[model samples]
Target: MSNDTFTSWENLVKKQLKTDDINAVLRKENLEGIDVKPFYTDVQQPLVNLPKIEESTHLVAKYHESLEEDVFAFLLNENVENLEQKTIFVNNVDLAGHISPKEEVQYFSLIDVFDEKNATVNDQLVKELLAKQFKRNICIDIALHQNSGASISQQLGIALAKAKELTEIYGTEILEKLIFKLAVGGNYFFEMAKIRAFKILFNQLSKEFNLNLTPYIFAETSLRNKSVSDSENNLIRSTLELAAAMIGGADAVYSNNYQIGNSTDNSEEISFKQQIVLAYESIINVFEDASNGSYYVEDITKQIAEKSWTYFVETEENGGYLELLKQGNIQKDIFDHAIEEQKWVEEGKIKLIGVNLYPKLEVKKSVEELYNNTEIKPVRWAEMFE
Candidate 1:
């Protein structure tokens, strides 16, 4: 619509609503330090695309090697010009047994050093990695912070802090292969903004380090959105989460099995196939930066970056992430956030589908039978209400 027509229409709406100023009436504030306007016009100021790269580079990256053989072979079948698409994420502890110079494979991988729920790289693994470079490229993952309810800004700041720590302890050489594995929560555009904000933060840090490096992001679906009782609904949640990751410029996407901390062959097959369908059948790869030029998305991305930068500076002033971790401030802060979130679920503020709404009568009736009577480990978000 023309600017003049938009102005006229806005005037009519303002009169109907009995408000003289539309911006004041319709705007709302968000956690990301931005205002949510009721409407949008053409760009008021110049804004750049998040990664500044073409869409082809952002095409869905790779698959989980843990999938059943026949299922994961889809990775081998999708031919491409380069060897990078063949890459997959692997645990650092498992690298020694799984790969060696003897194998004729080129895999781009994020060598997981620390996962808060499980383990970190031990002294021996660190020693082995320092001894010599392996065949596959490696990147360290800091996905645990997000899972624990840290804000997007905290995640970005902590990542840089951890990278610096690892660089000092391991070696700056590892940065050459560094990749960031991020867990995308169900925030849609905010999650998209998280990634773009990350790229911007890393780019600024790289300049400080005199390295012109960009991170290859591996996106994992969040554990927050998965529902145990309505297990079948996870595929739907995962599909949308995967789309957000790809459209946000994830080099690769990984979907978790619907059952939390439990992935059987069946779940693996389903998750892998779903990703294939999204990329190929659904054509998520057809566009480059699909969210680019979107007014709301672009604005949100900018706000996330700005807020995250402030967090980064505060983290540095507070003596980096390790110190904050030792003081238990980081964990406590996230825990407080989780407690607040739990209250929301309890109060019915959040719509968690089968967990809180639209549950089948049979499932509700069989809760005692189908559900585990024992304590659930690493509690689900909806556990308080359920």
Candidate 2:
């Protein structure tokens, strides 16, 4: 049977099996799960509109215009002055990488030091670029390095330290207006809670320095959890991640084109359409704080804040964040956590639809092979550091 036919059959079966005694059945099964009631009583209805948290005001401009000549020219003319108004977090630095150098200069520039030889070249590039124009914000993704080998604390420390260094170099006056783009992974609840915690931490940090800047968050579905085999399942994976981002109050989210993992045009169209559907068709934007009063979400937010704050304190105690990074403590922490998470996935404690569970028909694609075929280079922060 076709997938759609199977889905329909499953739905019909589920309807027939529906019962007002679902909670009782779950109790017998010791499931401790959410129960469905046959009907809602008027007394149980909500009385007031819940307080709303402001949504992040970030925008992700992944695809600007088509490659067709006439269309590109028209779009260019219309966007020439306002190009910097949109900035998308990029995954690779290859020739075919989403953002082109020409487009980078035209829309947004780097927010790091530009002096190639300076240890702080990344910071300098950002500062220099910000100085030239003040139209829209630019991204300096130091966090990408943390994905493969660095610790969360180290990533946080580096990002925080870099922002501080830039503020000092550029002066807080101009720094107040710049946006810092953070790349998050597919840790689901943890990722969502992390963003919320960062907001609080950033505000506290700003208060200490008497700087009044609110961060603009741009999140992208992680590439780390994606697998080359069963590439089609990436759609469901990214969809969940994107939903978490939106619920966590990301100003903007960019769903990775699935084929991106293999450097092919494979599922780019579908992935992009997924995001568009969520925004326009799905109407997810209709309500703010969609997860606001949820018992689980609220509890997780508190837990994450407490843990992250404890880590932040430890960083402060260890001669501050940057000092800890220089000693590689940050990297070690991240590595350890990654190892634990990998184990969880292996043991079925953490489920990855395609990788750990619901295994797919085998089809392999190597990063090296994909890179070679597409002539794309992954972004490497180590090179920038060196």
The candidate maximizing TM-score is 1
Full-model lDDT, candidate 2: 0.48
What ranges in model 2 sit over 4 Å off?
Answer: 1-61, 67-123, 135-146, 149-158, 286-288, 360-386
Highest-lDDT candidate: 1
* Tens-place lDDT digits, model 1, residues 1-386: 69899989998989988999878877864444466678867555645655533334332323435533423222332332323323334443454444443234334445555433322334565565544344335555656666655667767777777676666667776665567878888778888777777777777777777786666677778876676667777778877888888788776677767665567777766776677788778777445467888888787777777877777777678876666666556666566555555555555565687776785212222223322312112335655444
Q: Quote model 1's TM-score.
A: 0.79
C-alpha lDDT of all candidate models, in order: 0.62, 0.48
TM-score of each: 0.79, 0.64
For model 2, what is the alpha-carbon lDDT of residue 374? 16
Candidate 1 ranges beyond 4 A from true positions: 1-3, 11-33, 50-85, 101-104, 108-111, 115-124, 130-138, 261-264, 286-288, 359-379
User: In every candidate, how many clashes are there?
Assistant: 3, 15
> What lDDT is obtained when candidate 1 is compared to the true structure?
0.62
